[model samples]
Target: MNNSLQTMYIEMVEKALDRYVSTQRCNNDHVLEAMRYSVLGGGKRIRALLVLNFNRILGGAANDAMEFAAAIEMMHAYSLIHDDLPCMDDDDLRRGKPSCHVAFGEAVALLAGDALQTLAFETLARNTSLEPAQVLQAVRELAAAAGSRGMVGGQTVDIEGTAQTVEQLTGMCMMKTGALIKCAVRLGCLSVGADEASMAQADIYADAIGLAFQIRDDILDVIGSTEELGKPVGSDAEQQKATFATVLGTERAQSLAEKLTRTALDALKQLNVAEDDPLYEMTVELCSRKK
Candidate 1:
């Protein structure tokens, strides 16, 4: 079931992004190509999957949520593009291919990232299926998550080299990586007009899985090969970044990830879904994912 749902949702996201980007009438072909190169590049599309799956579980139309899901993916792609810039992580590869800046020039890559970020809001705002109020709310949610109060803020701390404790490192990971993830889940619930209680439950589920996802990423950096990660391994160590494995050691990091996965599973159980829910299955897969 998890395999099937993952395949289906990933296909949906790919198709949506392809159609949307292909139909765009851009004045600068190079920047557009850069956008396409970055966004259409391979990824697990987990955030978009979370949106679609949460909407499905909440009785919302997957079709209606498709635009929103694609928008979140675009935002994620934008983040990755910037993250790989020479001034940032300075990586030359992503998803086993040249990073956006490496493929396109630095200027074009910067514009592409900016364009993709604007495209995310544009996609959400232009979706006709959702109400204006809902779109606005989602925009606000994404802005808060991606802006200084969230992902960007965490990144600021990360580059400043100030995370001196395990707690601080955890906080940085939560914001830098978990903010958008949590927002993805919440946006799906909002698309369906879920109540406060339901949204709160979604919050719990997202929070746990989001942090767990980062922990797994950190763990994979230590043990996963470059081919497996689709990027250079040991980048954290190379950059001297603080990570769960660096701060807490391998055994404790793995234990904490397991605990977080358990917390996510407990939240899934509270959703009143069946024991074999796809969301629950996906969460399990996320907790133990090799990539």
Candidate 2:
């Protein structure tokens, strides 16, 4: 996206997250605090931006999409919190700060993640602006993406160390990382009643960019700095995890990302979208992003 619109999205997503976190309540405030810390912690908020931008493309109101955008971010934060647990990635850092498990005790961190996951669906269900059918459709989409069929399934494969090839690893990445992303974009269309053709093109674009995103992430893990990445770099290699960079080599991984970017752009073009469409720019920026 152009600098101005990109900045606008960042600001809007951040504000929505802050507002949502502030509204959450519980008798034991500690878990809530941890949830806030995890959800409000710094990151790109790419999923949220995806929802917002796609909603914009479908002529949906930005304000109307904020809740869905924030919901996606909550789900993403939940996944990250669990992903960094001792039994998972075993990372101590996230977004330049202590991971939730490190900052809070593991029990509280675990509860925080659970809460966020549920809250995401709650946010979608409670959105009264959309038709009840639309909200239900969005909820189902998110549930499938976050559940065993998507992110959880991918994580299972990753933890089992079952992937042994570039294609296998890429498939895992699609489920683990790209599923939520695809859901995010699709949610925008569903919420706005975008036609089936629009949704079809969105699927094409989301699928391509989702894989491209993981490839770029693998590339960053190889070449990125700890400071710039806001987390430990080279963790994939340290853990001997199969990744695009490891399977295809760095140069080939980079080329694959570009190729996927081209595919995403082509899909977007087939929709007859404007030349200045934010999705186009965002896809380009995502392929080249360093952190």
Candidate 3:
């Protein structure tokens, strides 16, 4: 996307998130604080941006897609909250700040994560501009992507198979890290009434980019400094977690990421989208992002 369009999209999303956080109230102040801390914590917000960009590319208005984008980010924030729990990754830091569990205690963090997940569904359901069917579809997509068959399942594999083969490692990462991103693109297209063929093409684009995103992340963890990443670097290696870089070597993993980016971009060519479309450009930009 053009710089001006990207700036507008980011500002719109930031405003929506700010308003949503301000409007929320909780019976328990501690839980609410934890929720706000986790949601408002700095991150790239790439998944939400994908939703907005894809909606625009499919001829949907940005205002029409704003609620859905915010919902996606809420769900993502909740996932991170839970993922950092002691039972999961047991992370102490996220985005350069103390993790929810570290800052607010585990019990409050868990409750906050639960609240965010529910709020995501509520956001979509209460959006007046979306058709009932569209809202329902988005909910279904989010549920499937975040449930046992997707992110949760991938985490299970990652925990259970610390010494897995290259293929197994790739499979786990694809589900754990890639599923929500794929859902983001799919839901955006659905919001604008994309045809089956178009959705199928979008799926192809998501699959490639999603995997590439993880591979690049793995590469970055090895080569990038903690200051640059805004979080602890080499944690995956220190934990003996299975990663593309662990199995494929850093050089080979970087090559694979490049290949996947190429495949993702090529998949977009099969669609009838414009060259200057925000979604098309965003896809390319995401693959090229330094962070």
Candidate 4:
């Protein structure tokens, strides 16, 4: 799986993220603490890895993508903070520690999310390595993904619990989870000015993996342990969330995830990356992730 390369990329992303959310940047000490707590809180960093690896694999300097990767991670972290708010999922645990709203007050956590989200765009707009047009394109991609018609739209539907059928939930999952995931690769393609065909392949790959990721998460929530997941398992069922696992039985869901993993790998055929590429490895890893 080229674990060492994966680790290096993850370290690069972590450093970039820390640099963006550093003490010198956040003026308010209290909010800074909350921002750091959530942004720096450990997770798989899969989204950032997707950004860097896709960029590098598509002929962009991985370094050029680092800031953008950090920006995406910031956005992801912000979403997590807001997702755990009292008005949202209202869970207490995140990454095995108290959620942002639990560790910090709800107000601070909310502000922390808001600040982190803005910082993401700032980081993108501030980058000098990429051309102005590329940066602007990246901004548009991120905005569309994070904005009301994308992730926010999916979240609104989920909160409303309006999705009953599998098709409806799958569509919602695409908006909520797939939007950012697809945007990560799209930014990678944009960073390198990859060809239209290449970008199209990457989007197809992202779509398959993104759905597999959420389906796997639904599976894990049912069968995984709190110690492994770093949060309470079975919370989806507890909340009566319409998950792939709930809509389809775990066996069927597992089968579907495997099928999607194959589809993701197949779409990457046109990217011309060898099977040994970290992108391929990570997609496979995600398919069987225990946490």
Candidate 5:
């Protein structure tokens, strides 16, 4: 059942993402090509899936949440493109393909990231299925999550706090990697008019899983193969980037990831949702994922 659900979810997200890129129009072919390339670059689309799952949990239609999901994905993609720049991580590859800066020039890649970031807001604002108020709220949530107060701020700390202690490093990872994830779930709840209590419950789940997600990522960087991960293995070590493996050691990091997954599952219990719910199972599987 989990396999079926995962396959279905991946298919749905892929179709939505494909449509999103194809529908976009730009004056410059180069800019358009870069944007499409960056977005079409394959990924797990976990953030978008989180949005969809929470939207369902909150009683919103999946279709109603589709635009917002796509928007969030665009924002995520933009971040990755910028993160892989020569001035940033200087990654040459992503998802088994050349990095955006490698596929296109650095200037075009930068423009593509910028375009995708702006397009995220545009997509959210243009979501006709949602009320104006809901759309506006989602936009505001995304702005905070993606902007200086959230992911960007976290990234700044990550770069500056490289030599910091484990606690500081964890805090940076939480902000940089977890903020947008929290926003994804929160926006889904808001879309369905969930009460404060329900939103808070969702927040607990998001917070735990968000941190777990990053911890697993750090683990993957150490142990996962490039073929399985679709990116260079041990890139963090190669770049001397501080990670959970670097500070806490691999065994403890793995244990922490398991603990966080339990925390996320426990938070979901407050929802009174079904045990057999696909979202619940997906959340569990995500933390335990090998790749």
Candidate 6:
């Protein structure tokens, strides 16, 4: 990520995310604590950035989009918590600390993930700045993206060993990762009631980066160090999960990522985006990410 992204995550997103998970607001102290811990544990926060930046670009205030942005991050955090469960990816390291199931008991972690997911919708609905229709639109899109038709669908496919080819893998990535990324873009646009043309162009940008981002993840899983990534590497290979690297080879996967990034940049250019926009820098950096 770039300096702007870091600053946004630290100065803006962190506070918004924290304000929602206070222990005083829940039933059991343990699940509430776990929810707080998991949500605050942290990551790149790329989804929230997509929401805020797209909103800002379309003449909406960043402050006005805070609830939507923060809600998406909560959704993302819940996904990570569930993904790291023993029955799922089975990882014991997350956000440079013990996995949710390790830091908290499995039952508590499961309930916590469930809680965060519901809380995400509540947070989205709590948005006071946006129109009711606008908020409804975002909520509808988010539910679809997070439900059986989208991210969870992708996870099911991944676990079921259905992605045997490059095309299948790409399709899976679209739902697993691209759905949220695309939804973030949509949420931003909806916040400001952006025109159809801009929304179309934004989708083009989102799709390219979304897949490109996954391609980079595949590359990193092969070559990234555990210390740098804050998680164990080679799990994909060990699990025999097919990836861009496995299907297309590392060199070709790298080439594909670069090509997809170019496509993303071209979409932004078509929209006449400013040259110094953080999105431009972020898109460029995604291809060369070391971790």
TM-scores of the candidates are 0.97, 0.97, 0.94, 0.97, 0.94, 0.97
Clash total of candidate 5: 0
Better of 3 and 6 by TM-score: 6
User: Backbone clashes per model, in order?
Assistant: 0, 2, 0, 0, 0, 0
Give per-residue CA lDDT, model 1, range 35-124, as digits (tens): 999999889899999999899889999988888899999999999999999888898889999999999999999999999999999888
Global lDDT of each model?
A: 0.89, 0.90, 0.83, 0.89, 0.84, 0.88
Off by over 4 Å in 4: 23-27
Which candidate should be chosen as best, given lDDT against the real structure? 2
Off by over 4 Å in 3: 272-278
Runs with alpha carbons beyond 4 Å of true place in candidate 2: none
| Clashing residue pairs for model 5 | none
Tens-digit lDDT track of model 4 for 1-291: 349988998889888888878733555688999999998889888888888888888878988888789999999999999988879888899999999999989989999999999999999987789889999999999999999877899999999998877789789989999899988988888889888889889988999999999889889999999889888898889989888999998999999999999999998877787788878888899999998
Worst 10 residues of 3 by lDDT: 282-291
After superposition, candidate 1 runs with Cα above 4 Å error: none
Error of 2 at 145 (Å): 0.3
* lDDT winner between candidates 2 and 3: 2
CA lDDT for candidate 1: 0.89
- Which stretches of candidate 6 lie above 4 Å from their native place? none
Q: lDDT, candidate 4, residue 200?
A: 82
Candidate 2, residues 30-81, lDDT tens digits: the string is 8999999999887887888888888887888887878899999999999999
In candidate 4, position 126 carries an lDDT of 74
**Residue 163 C-alpha lDDT in model 4:** 83
